[model samples]
Target: MTVSPLVWTLTVALILGMLVYDFVFHARKPHVPTMRESAIWSAAYVGIALVFGLVVLALWGGDFAGQYYAGYITEKALSVDNLFVFLIILATFRVPRQYQEEVLLFGIAFSLIARTGLIFVGAGLINQFAWVFYIFAVILLATAGSTLKEALKGDEEEEGDSRFIKLIRRIFHTSDEYDGNKLFTHLNGRRVMTPMLLVMIAIGGTDLLFALDSIPAIFGLTQEVYLVFTAVAFSLLGLKQLYFLIDGLLDRLIYLSYGLSAILGFIAVKLFLHALHENNLPFINGGEHVTVFEITTSLSLSVIIGILVVTVLASLYSPRGRAMSVVSATEMLSERYLQLPADATDSQRDAISRKLARQLQRMPRISDSLKDELISDRRHYMELLHEVHGEHLDYLSARQSSDDTSSAESAELERRKTAFSDIVNPAAESVGSAEESVGSTAPEGSSEGRPQHH
Candidate 1:
């Protein structure tokens, strides 16, 4: 159904108005928003979108607008799912709370450009070949099935050193710490990249992978390039804020992908039917021509809402929405710490252990089994005792005894950090200090890879 020219003009005006409000009122600062502030802004954005949908219903007779809104809602769902990985990346970076805004802003902007390009590619596919819809359907179906697999298994922690990342690390010089958002730094007449730059590439590269799932899913919604582009564009417009607002809620949305897959499967079938209706081909008799699919705006809206509700409810009610057994090693270390030399006060021992645990947790090589056991694991307790002793040797040992042979090792780490700094990542303790890193204990058993987390 065609809408009046006046309605289109009004919709454009509304879209521009929201952009103005966002720029003027919401995005004045590059700072992290508090929970209350994030909650209010998120609600306001959703309300604005909802109000626009209602206006679409009233003015355009709910036909074209319905499809647009459903597509927007679905795209928004996929964008939220993107945030799940964003959280992991952010936490891994240990980005200072204040600097996260910059990382997120950069990420959102990059994703918008990337997804817009994806939308056009998707539109081209469906337009060029009718059978492309089935390919998209199968892609969506496989991605949807992956949801069940993902739900059943936890994501394995990938090592930071990917081959590409390693090659880049070898190829560039980098800074030791963040140089206040500069992607690269130079020291002693040698140019170096920072962790920030590598992180940015990692994030952009990762988002490109995520787009594989999302582009297909949104295509399942609407084949019209304009509708698909606008819907995806608008859904992503507020994503940086959405990341902070729903950061905590994401862990609770454990079944989120399943919900997304279900919606995509629904939309895939809808688009396929729409394709069949418009097909001029005769060779494929399986294609049934129907003028209109029953998929209206309301039904699409219901599916989106139902998926969110069920996802949230399932996560909330999940019996194992927890680490099978988990506790911060820091806390446990503080609890059982005994003062050396027997007469030391409790406060001193606790302080020492807390400081040491913080230093240790920043190291990545701890076996998860040992990590999961906390202070309760006798083996882990023994390792800590050796590490404390190792720290002493590290401080007193001769500068000549150990190799600092190449400043290249330091240079390489700088390059990795510089390269990755644009994306927030977990803090990495310096590894050049062999004592802090290689502090080893006589193992009760063969300790290799990651000790099994039980």
Candidate 2:
């Protein structure tokens, strides 16, 4: 169905208005959303999406509505996969918990803008060339294969070491520390890019890459530009809240990659069939359309939902999934503890330590069932946890004492800090030490001799 210019204009305005409202009312203040807040807002966005779908059904007929739902569901599932990378990026940067909301909102907004451009480009390609479907089919098929391979290998690519991020770092003078939500800050009497900006760039770049696959996958479901644009926009609208709601549970969905692979592979077949049905290449079938099987939108939606349901249920019930969740939770809590600022309150420290301790207590029960590699990793992190716990105790003791610490106590504290830093980020620690050594050897009055605060 062709959409009118006025309808398109209104739709774009509504999406942009919602984004503005979200930023002004919700994300303007940097704060970690409570679980209840995340849930409520997430459901609200979903409800709005569903209500809009019903409006489509009333005006555009059931066929168009089915296409919209299928496209929306596919895009939403792909967005969940995107979150895995987002979680890694945030953790790698050690973004402050309260300020994560701002970063996520920026990422979401960037994703919408980036994907909207790609969607139009894809539509243009489809309009101008019938052979584009074949290309899209191949892309989806290859992506599915690679996704499955990674799932089988049980390895995730480190987003922190991406070449794009490396290029950005090499091109810009970046400060290691974040200056609140600001992208640039004054450091050493000069302005420098902050980690906050780097992370936002990282997320935005990753979102562009994610769009390459997701756009093709959604187009395979429906070629209508209106449905594609609205589906994708609504899919991303609630993504930030969804991230918070499911962040802790993400690791438990061990079969997610497998399910995504299956979904993409199914969509690939659909696109291939559609390509054959609209064949225009002279080399194949003498440039004539072939009457082959076509997958209906309703069938696509049903299959996608079925696969997701089964995937979630299997992951939740599997023994290994439980073990992996425990390990992941332990690692997350440990990193959060280490990432806490020097001025963190005692209650903040106590909360994380208590959670880490509980995760540690659960580890022994699952240790016998874990693979050797995981067991080794767990052991390594366990040592780090013990050290962190010891440091916490020392900090509490120091706070309790009203007198100044002796040289020995101060040295001991420094040693523990170095040890923790080495365990968590050895490369960074080594680099910092090298810089410190260079500074120590420099002349006293030289700017190079002044220690830089990270």
Candidate 3:
């Protein structure tokens, strides 16, 4: 008797137990999670999955363990690739950093249920008919086609309702605005579902579409339902953690599709082979098991690790092109901050942030004091720049002119003020980087760190 079912049940229980731990105790009493917190938690989540995989292998003999792990690795890699789109979705909504956690957690929760349903249906299909492999293979290839389009396609002229979303909206009335990550609520004294629910629904639905690729790909590796589900579940459980950790890094992995495409191509071939093995075709039916190159569980494990490492390194070390992508992203974020009008979503904002980050990066090289001064008064400097026109800045000296001030102390204060006159409007920068600020230089002026009143 195969122990697959029991093993998977226990594995699922363990997963839910951890998730419950996080929900009840761990994620509860937090001063908001910082980048540091994101990094730590992400590492912990991945580490748990890895260590857990080893335990699965140890307890269930080598074969089932391999099947489970191979499936898991494939799912995890696909999940990471899925995050690039999440980055876009979040940016589109302009989700706040603090509230982003709630968004992703909600998304992950709904996705787990949806994917579980998809997996069960898929397993049932495979059990019932041999021709289902062809259906599965076609869906996977189609998904790969769509994914390639998403990866390679440039900005669309506009966003539209997805077919599924449009259909849902057509059938039922839904509200447009978010209700603080609340899925459903009352509006205008009537019960209404929130866009937050729609967004989660969109995400969960898209993942189901993606499952068309992922489920079939893993099924190529294992016929065991328990192994299949265990791997898919484990992979998904880590997604919210990954989203928190890597939202900033998404743009860097610009070539993520190439990697994913290679993975898909690899799986597509595997599915074709598995189809060949089980088919009733005249020549191949009852034919001997044709061994392809030795692709073992250990190799798949190593391949997964290698792919993740290389993708990350390639992204970080690739050309510094992420600047505009991130800035473009910054512009898309309008839901939370109405800092910019719709038109301000241009390349200028991206350039400014990139320039500022680069300046901060180069601070040590120029002069530590200069660096500190630049950073410490960043907001103040932005403000001054905002107040003065280009011509006005041109008139000021390296220090505010002594004549420009009414008193000696005032002159000193004015100088300080000039140092920071460039600073203004932090809230405004949220929607998009204003072009006026990106390249605007401070006027040369004699200045003190204090502000001098005009």
Candidate 4:
């Protein structure tokens, strides 16, 4: 467990190199990775981790190597659990498949940094205080209970409305939609955060909760900070590829939560046993060393690996799992269809359309009749959009024409009234003048003229 400065430097460099390679090659271009691509990358990363374990075995003794393997297995299992939350976040945000890699990468980076700090603090506290193991055990036991409850209910979607997300919404001016992969975009003249940003924040917040269990669990396996850190780093590497490679498999792994609960429960008992063995508390066995059975690292590692295998096998063969597969596939496609943005580019739309069509064709329960009907509906939707667009244009044109006709008619009516007013006013003035002149001439001799006539 004695890690030299040289070893530390080399290890950090390797991890950084792997991250950079992932970024430059796999994540540089945004695309839905093909299954083959995901499989190859996932296998390669796992292979690298196995090789690293072998190197640790050669450098250190068998005990340290065993501890490393156990820690890695435990962390890897926990990482799978973390994936459930990741899927929820992605689906809740309706992240486009292409940008999902970016989101996961950001999440992984944030988790790594945050875990490193937690590891340091945890190591320091464990060195100073032996009771931390008891606390860790209690926490892991509680987490196991929580995990078991969630598994029984199958309620990963509850993470979609996490308080972290609500807090962010309250604090920031956020867009109701994504702006490609950008975390921030200009809406009008103000800056607004996108769903991408919100997802990353959610991932970070969840990772913090996960670390509360993971760090202590690893500490129980080995107090060597180097082993704990390396195990976590290796376990988390290439998780993005694993996410894609096993995307469909996740739903089928219905027993994973149960397996995880068992693992956590077992580890918690181990931690408590170790705490008893090294008891320093006044109330516990009169502060004396208790003769509790200590579980070896090899046993712990074997149990974890065995549980994971059994869980996977049981899930794949279970009737419920089989039923869920079809339902999950349908739900995934439905989400994709619903999430297609109205303002998405044509290429983006076509990509999603083709993806949905392929998924529909691959579904065994979906009859050919249904497939054809779904395809027909897709086409009909496009046709309806075009028809609606044309109708909207026609309606606008008719409205403009009616407005112009009304305006012209009003102008003609006003012009006719003006002409009539001009002619009538001139006649009225001349008649008034003629009446005034006749009255003026007759007024002087009106009585005398009238009498002679009589």
Alpha-carbon TM-score of each model against the true structure? 0.65, 0.84, 0.69, 0.75
Off by over 4 Å in 1: 1-30, 156-161, 280-282, 286-294, 322-454
Give residue 53's lDDT in candidate 2 (0 to 100).
99
Tens digits of lDDT, candidate 3, 272-316? 666666675446545444444535666665665576678667756
| Candidates, ranked, lDDT | 2, 4, 1, 3
Question: Which numbered prediction scores highest in lDDT against the true structure?
Answer: 2
RMSD of 3: 9.7
Instruction: Estimate the TM-score for candidate 1.
Output: 0.65
lDDT scores for all predictions?
A: 0.59, 0.81, 0.58, 0.74
User: Considering TM-score, where higher is better, how would the candidates rank from best to worst?
Assistant: 2, 4, 3, 1
TM-score: model 4 vs. ground truth: 0.75
Error of 3 at 287 (Å): 8.0
Q: Who wins the TM-score comparison?
A: 2
lDDT of 4 by residue, 1-454 (tens): 6899999999999998998888888677888898899999999989998888899999998899899889988999899888988998887787888999998988888888889999999999989999989999999999999999987875655565688789888988999888888989989889999988888888888888888889988888899999999999998898999999888778778899999999999999999999999889999889887998999988998998999999988888765565456445544544554454556564654454445444333344434443343333433322222222222233233434464557766565445334433432232222234343233221211222111110
Question: Candidate 4 clashing pairs?
Answer: none
Q: Root-mean-square deviation of each candidate, in angstroms?
A: 12.8, 8.5, 9.7, 24.3
State how far residue 190 of model 1 sits from its true place (Å).
2.3
lDDT of 1 by residue, 1-454 (tens): 4546775577566655766566556545545587788777778777777676676567556665777787888888888877777766765554545556667666766776788788778778777877777677787777777766775665533423456677888877766566766688878888888777776776787778777777877676656565666676678767767877766456556567667767777777776675666665666564545576546657777887788788767765654222211123332332234214345453655455445445444434444553443334544444444444333222223222338635665455344333332111121122223353243432221233222211
